[model samples]
Target: MKIGNLIRLVIFGLLLVFLIQPELFAGFFGLFTKNNQPAIYNQGSLLDITLNHLGIVAAATLASTIIAVGLAIVVTRPFGAEFLPLSRSLANIGQTFPPVAVLALAVPMLGFGTAPTLVALFLYGLLPIFENTLTGLTNLPPAVTDAAKGVGMSGWQRLIKVELPLALPVILAGVRLSVVISLATATIGSTVAARTLGEVIIAGLLSSNTAFVLQGGLIVGVLAVLIYDALSALERFLMKRTGQLGRA
Candidate 1:
């Protein structure tokens, strides 16, 4: 009901309209320029592709968030600080590795389809989520920890009741970043016969049909926008509800 929400809705409507009916806008303006081929947008293929892509992305993201954040928590204390740099280095290496190379090496073991792609996506998601989780929990005010101790709260109780809630916003923002990255990386799954929005783009690239590429890329962008926007809104809502952040 708020004006900001209204504006978000309006923008979403416009994006949906264009994504669902790209030809309407494409035909209005001459955007396709490839090998002089007629533009084509295959709806069924696009839908199937996007769905599979989202599936791989979601699985990878969920797995990465669990593993990365768990490890981050394990390595943050005085006794564990020695492990912090190692954990961070591994995270950095995960991001530095080429997903294409990962896929190539994994293909022999995992075969084709979504499995290898899932591994690559999972690896890509680990660093940001891990770093964010660590930073969020560490940023807590020392006074809050003291207050928890003064109340005779157990360590786990302090973590669950105070740290987790206070750190949730930053963790959620990290999740948002991983989500967008996941959506984009899912496109690469198409190389291994895994369905995704990248199918059209790759097909276009191979066949010299620019419209096909444009359609796929645009749809992926639109989906990313929708998912990120929703997550961002959810983050804001939770932060406000927790009283950890001021309401806008």
Candidate 2:
């Protein structure tokens, strides 16, 4: 493997180790602590908090992908073309309102915990996926789509067999962007009592313990980078398979 690839693997391995056995690094973290404070966050298990964080992000990202991709597909269809503006506006709502504002609005209706957080993340993550999917579907080579129709494929068949396949790399790019954003944004969920790595950072901040903040930030940062790299690899693979690598 290339040196870059090898380094990423090594970093990923360390991340897994850190999550699973954070206590093992207590000595390292101790350097950042003062006044006899605990180095590792003892209020919660790093592994559990990390898992919950991942779960929330995964759920929100999945929902965003499904809804965004579906909306993009609808808008791209001739019958639904007129609604493109509406769809764009709807997706833009998430971007227009900040996640914290969404959380504030949702908390009264959804209550605290995961529900409000999910709503915030779901809305926050919509634009990238929706816009990318729309761009991908709208920018397809007319010749390729026309050939599919010329071969006697129905509209649905053409979309399913030809258009979607060609557009997947682009769609995946959007999903990747959303996922990375969600990973970082989800940290704020802890402000409303949601279980997330934000708890660690918040605790650190409240107690003036830099160790906790660094630990939480480091884990989230590493996770975002690793996930981004993995998705980029997938996008490149798909582009290569579709003979669009050169274009990329």
Candidate 3:
């Protein structure tokens, strides 16, 4: 692994350690187990909580990525240019609005448990993806396209062989950003009973068992790092396959 990758791995481990401090201490100082009832969540297990958050975050991110990419493709096209600003702004607004506020507003209709969070997270994750897609596609060098055109390649051919290949790395970078953000945001799902890592945090807060919160938060943080690292590796693999990154 590169020095940078090693550094990131170390940092992630340190972060996990800090977040789970209460648990580590609970086993020693016994401060955590004192007066703690079996946590309301699955006999004090944080696994259930972490899984729920990850599920919603993953699902919402997938939906957002698909929609964002589609809208990005259309918005970058000439016919879509006139309204591009509006589309971009709407995506931004989605990110800017608080997830909790969105939950409150949406809960009346959505009624709870994953649906509101799914909608809000999808909206929240849109801008980075949509904007990045726009930037990546537009920033392609003119010479690449001119060469394709000069060689009598059709528009579709130019996009597939020239534009998309070159633009994919940047586009995937945006995807990485959205995925990480979605994972962190998934904690908000707990407030609506969406079965996520948030349950750990909330349960800890409610019961005053700091260890529970720490455990959940630590796991969630680790999960986020793992998720992001995997996506980054995938991005690198794609970049290499596309000739955007140098091959080993």
Top candidate, metric lDDT:
2
Instruction: List the pairs of residues colliding in candidate 2.
Output: none
TM-score order of candidates, best first?
2, 1, 3
Q: Model 1, which residues run further than 4 Å from truth?
A: 1-4, 10-38
Stretches of candidate 2 above 4 Å error?
Answer: none
Q: Over the full model, what C-alpha lDDT does candidate 1 score relative to the true structure?
A: 0.81
Which lDDT tens digits does candidate 1 get at residues 82-161? 89888888778658888888889889999998898898988889998998999889988788889999999987798889
lDDT of 3 at 57: 79
- How high is the CA lDDT of each candidate model? 0.81, 0.94, 0.75
Give the TM-scores of the predictions, in the order they appear.
Answer: 0.87, 0.99, 0.82
Clashes of each: 0, 0, 3
> Model 1, poorest ten-residue lDDT window?
40-49
Which ranges in model 3 have alpha carbons more than 4 Å from their true place?
A: 1-31, 36-45, 246-248
On residues 11-101, what C-alpha lDDT tens digit does candidate 3 reach at each position? Answer: 7776455444424444442445457554333444454455567678778888887888778777777788787878888788776888888
